[model samples]
Target: MPRGGIGRHGLRPPPRRFRCVTAGRDYRDVARTQWWRAAAGAWLLGMTLEYIRYRIAEPDRAEFEAACARAAVPLASAPQCRAYELSHCEEEPGSYILRIDWTSTEDHLKGFRASDAFHAFVAEVRPYVRDIEEMRHYAPTRVAGAGAGAAEDTAPNLYEWAGGAEAWERLTEAFYREVHRDDLLEPLFRHMDAHHPHYVALWLAEVFGGPEHYTEERGGFQRMADRHLGKGITEQQRRRWISLLMDAADEVGLPADPEFRSAFTGYIEWGTRLAVANSRPGAGAAGWAPVPKWGWGVAPPRRS
Candidate 1:
């Protein structure tokens, strides 16, 4: 409503909020804000942040970004590098900041500096060393998080990502439509129950971090394994099943993020491979095992 009073979040400045107006500036107020920030920074006690400010010409921006992308490979693999981000300045297009979080200042200087990953990282970014204006480590303060953020699910489970039971139902329904037409897999399910797809969907939902209805009402892994017994699943058919299911996933609009898709495919491969093995004569399928709840990158325990 008034000029010069609005803050970053579009709210009127609070008495406790930090401000930089020379007209009514109080040196004590500034000192109090710094004191509060340092005291609250306990959230990131041991971690050290290194902000590297770069002033690159407009022409060099593309090459600089590409170099940083290449350099990220080593940072991702390095033990001492906790996290990193290369950010662009909105107000000044020529300005960029590369922020990296290290496990500790000691670990970064003494540990990562001596590692092979650091050497590889340096080779990618050495050309821009002269363009850097600031490169130093600072500790994080309790002053974390942001406002007006997008609605992102921070839950670490695949079930939520797959959109629960209804999503699974859609997936199986679409998949069976393909299986019904494909000659390779059609004959295998020709004599199957009408509710086979529904049950299979339940199994999938339960396995990938959904509810335990498959285990609760329809029976668990043993029942599932027994269904495949003596079906004589072949490698060609197994691969075909995977293809149809993946196509169905696309058709049904499953989450296509790399992490989600990779984890989903990992489970599919595991189940299908085991199904092929268990369908063969006298194969010892696992029984009485607890139903697995798959997450971001977790896999079931090895059978052997």
Candidate 2:
């Protein structure tokens, strides 16, 4: 006996089963049970073919946007596609996730991995991306319900005033580069390779829609800032930096568009409030914030 181990190999033996269990079962019954079990397993497998999810990381937001646009073309051409959309992480700016629905797993396999368009697109967008992870699910545990001819669903409300996705990307990127150049934001830039031409593939993706954008590991933003806070920033310095950002917005051509100007103002106001919240001692030490989904723009007219 070694150190209270019950078995020689330190493994527990299987529990004994009753004789009645085996004796009562005949070969025909066991075969039927096995067949039904296999059928159920096949049904579950079929459900998995209906849903697919892809997780992508884009360390740089601009190039990510470009890549997202580039990935769209082949995906649109893909025959198995029933529904699809790209979503940016609410909490993490540079992260992207793509969700898609397909009729069947065989159809999806035939359209994507086996398709010619996928190869061409991969060659075009592979350089900008860090990694892509994909999973197939038997059922969508979380999804919006299909409405019964009620109101039409629209794009993310936050993007309406910015004139859909394109305007939003241009204004946001130009504004970020121009204003957020302080040490607080510089680390992200340093981690990103701006001069690397591999990003051009990403640029095409942004223009067309392909899998070029890469997402970062989420969380830990405020902690990273706290480590360098007192050394690089003061209360007064932070305010000045914000003002410089507003100036940069003007420089980067955001102020020229009234919609972007208004949206920027709202963003600044919300951000200032967020900073105040973070400053309170021992308040939400996680330093997380919610992103609003409603847009500053007016809603589109409903069709009859």
List all candidate RMSDs to the true structure: 16.5, 25.8
Q: Candidate 2: deviation at residue 290, Å?
A: 34
Residue-by-residue lDDT tens digits, candidate 2, 1-304: 1111111111111111201011123233332222222221121123222322234455455554455457667766877654444444445544444445455666767657788767765664576545455544343222222123311234223234334445445544554564346665454345554532233223222222122141122122333224332233346645754676567556544434554455456545554444555555564443321112122333232333
TM-score winner = 1
* Local lDDT at 196 for model 2: 27
| Local distance difference test, each candidate | 0.68, 0.39
Q: What's model 1's TM-score?
A: 0.48
Clashes of each: 3, 16
Best by lDDT: 1
Whole-model lDDT, candidate 1? 0.68
List of clashing residue pairs for candidate 1: 40-142, 41-141, 41-142
